[model samples]
Target chain A: MKQRHYKYIVPILLGTLFSCQKSSNNEDFNQIVEANPIETEVDVSSEIAMQVIEQMPSPLEISAIIKKTGLSYNSGILNPITHMENYTTNSQKAINFGIYATDLGYVNMYNSSQDAMNYLETVSSLSQDLNVSHFFNFELLQKLATNEQNLDSLMHISTQNFEEINDYLAKSQRGDLGALIIAGGWIEGMYLACEVHQKSDHKSLREKIGDQKVSLSSLISLMNAYKSNPDVELINKDLMKLQNIFNKIQVKEHTRESKVIEEDGIPMYQDKKVLTVMVTDDEINQIRTLVIDLRNRLVK
Target chain B: MTLKRLFISCFMLNSFIMSSECNLEEFSKNAAQKLAGYTYLKTYKLDASKEAEIEYSYVFSNNTQYVLTLAHELETTDILVSIYDNNRKELCNNYDKKGKKYFQGIGYSCSATGIYYVMFSFKNAKNKCGASVLGFKK
Candidate 1:
């Protein structure tokens, strides 16, 4: 027994020593790994997925159009900053983050500093809850909001901050939360359009509202991608009801020629297409009702 | 020296190589610089090959103005950007009135509300790498 134990110990010690010396040096380790390139399958699906989500319209565009329509800031139509506390779950917080972001955009476009500051606070809170506070510069944004003259810079900063937040979420494998934020923003934008259109008749704004059918489809597709998540399933079900209504709306597309013209020695090209929305007053009313119901479910 | 340590180093090196391949972070930073002051909506990476076109479908609302900016290594690459309506009709391409193809950006004032596609590709690009940023003003 003693002889056998000694024989085993000698070989074990020799093996350990050889192994340590083999990879002990940094240069040798590097060379060994270099000689045999490690196979790593790069997955950029997260980046691509985020890119697709970003393609969805920014609620800011809708808010900007509403502003251009010569409409005053109807504070009543927006989600109140007070509702910020009701969002307890990650899903709720994510969606409300989107909702507050749209509200902030509307207020900013109208140069309503007080409302902007309020919504900014709510946005900061939601972002913090989601652990994305690092992307949001609350102090800087507050100072920018205080000075109305810096609206452009403020918009730029806010947009970049959101982009960073979404990117970080995607990288961290929390893309589902990012999607909820976008869906929330889209729903709020739709709600605003429905609300404003119900109040006034602006042909351009009507067309813009009707055009949301396409975006709604995109949003549904996005949500459907994560239908397995219970939170996502609930949102998907609600959006599908809107999708069913949108299916009835017809969009007539006409081909048009695009031409490039020279302006100040630069080539300027203006491409326009003719799309006629065939939706009756009844159809829009149905949409408006559903939008209110959906948004209420989110806010309440 | 241990098997576990060797495996860990290999994994680390693999991640390093993967990131170093395209360096998307660097590309995004460069693109972000060009899109400064503009509210960035999205960024798309264009492959270096002229034939490698990337198309994105977006809902371009009416009565709003959109600006699409392209960023690339100035000395190494050139990219062409274009927009088309839902009807597959070309709205705008980064081409001069003289039909010259050298251009970097296109601005579209959308008067019609519908879905549109923004397409990007390299134009006689030597490096075959770059990105484009989208911004809109209402």
Candidate 2:
């Protein structure tokens, strides 16, 4: 048994030795690992596999896609800022915090400074209620929201702040709350996408909605990690329903080597494969109806 | 020498068995500025487990030009990144094998939407503190 231990451990020691020699950033390994925010005892269950929610596209991605369509801004489509007070529980606060962040993103995308400021204040309030306000720079964000030229910075900072809050929550024992934030943000993004689609019936937007199948399964798996919580369990049940509808959409995939081109000394690859997303009008309607209904139920 | 090896064996056992994390207080913002002309979407702090590579999956939409900007406390772009399509097909890498050069990021424009797995590793197994930020423009 002792000889076996040496055989496996020697190689790791040599690897560490080489790593330490080449390491330019000489951080004290033990101290740094001790201070890592991801050191929390995660309660993520193991039944569901591929549980990675951290890299899911920002809730703002759908908003960015919607804004590029030249659709007119509609404040009525957003969750009302006045409803921020109704969420008293930690779960409610975290979820609404995410919803308000997405709403704030939409407001920023349209360059509505006044509306952005309102959403910013409300998001800050909710983040405060959730004890995550330290992750946000409310004054700087408010200042940026007032200037239309700062729209990009405002959007980036808002998204980054929400990411920080989620990270902090994950570091503590509240990773379930982080999952809830993602769930809320994702549902609101879909709701906004569906509502915008209802307005114009954009063909590309429909495909984009269908393309969300990739993240949908991962989000569902992530939610299942925290299914022990009542809020997470209920949300996961609804997400599974969404997943079922998404499962019905057909996507044919093929792959080939991308044509690589050099841009400013960087490699930019143009993917050759194109997938035709086959989502019928009926499926779209089902997804849209369910998204709107689910979002409304959560917020109301 | 035998005692030293024994101590290292025990230490390695502890590290390999436990979860690895990094101390990246402000990882993303520091790198986002480098990749201008693109709107920041998502950022990931790399776990500093040198023995293992970090893999993150993101759903990238086609027709949108996306860039994955990498930053490190090492102050060099020598960090290794390999991007794979949803099918785990190799798409592109930051290393220039011909020129022996390393770029700071990978730019990808796909014609189809799928989950792309971005893997980041350090060349010398020295990946304790670094991050990757994903930015896009349609």
Candidate whose TM-score is highest: 2
Each model's DockQ score: 0.22, 0.29
lDDT of 1 by residue, B1-138 (tens): 699999999999998776435555567556656553345666666664435677776777765666776666777566777787766667667766566555656777776766677777766666667777777666
Docking class of 1: incorrect
Per-residue CA lDDT of model 1 for A146-232, tens digit only, reads 888977667767877887777677667687788788888899988898889878877766777777776776677566545546787
State each model's C-alpha RMSD to the native. Answer: 15.5, 11.9
For model 2, how does the per-residue alpha-carbon lDDT over B26-47 read when each residue is reduced to its tens digit?
Answer: 5666777766778888776776
Evaluate candidate 2 by giving its C-alpha RMSD to the native, one decimal.
11.9
RMSD in Å for model 1: 15.5
- The true-versus-predicted C-alpha distance at residue B81 of model 2, in Å, is 1.3
Off by over 4 Å in 1: A1-48, A255-257, A263-266, B1-40, B43-55, B73-76, B84-92, B97-101, B111-115, B124-131
* Model 2 quality (TM-score): 0.79
TM-score, B chain alone, candidates in order: 0.73, 0.75
For model 2, residues A1-300, the per-residue Cα lDDT tens digits are 000000001113324431111111122222322332332222332211222556467767788789889999999999998997788888888787778788888888889999999999998888877788898899999899999999889998888888777767766667788888988998888889999999999876888788788778767756655666789888878888888988899887776765877766568878878776789899999899888888898897
| Model 1 residue B114 CA deviation in Å | 4.6
User: Relative to the unseen true structure, what is the C-alpha lDDT of residue A115 in candidate 1, on a scale of 0 to 100?
Assistant: 80
Off by over 4 Å in 2: A1-42, A45-51, A254-257, B1-30, B45-52, B72-77, B124-130
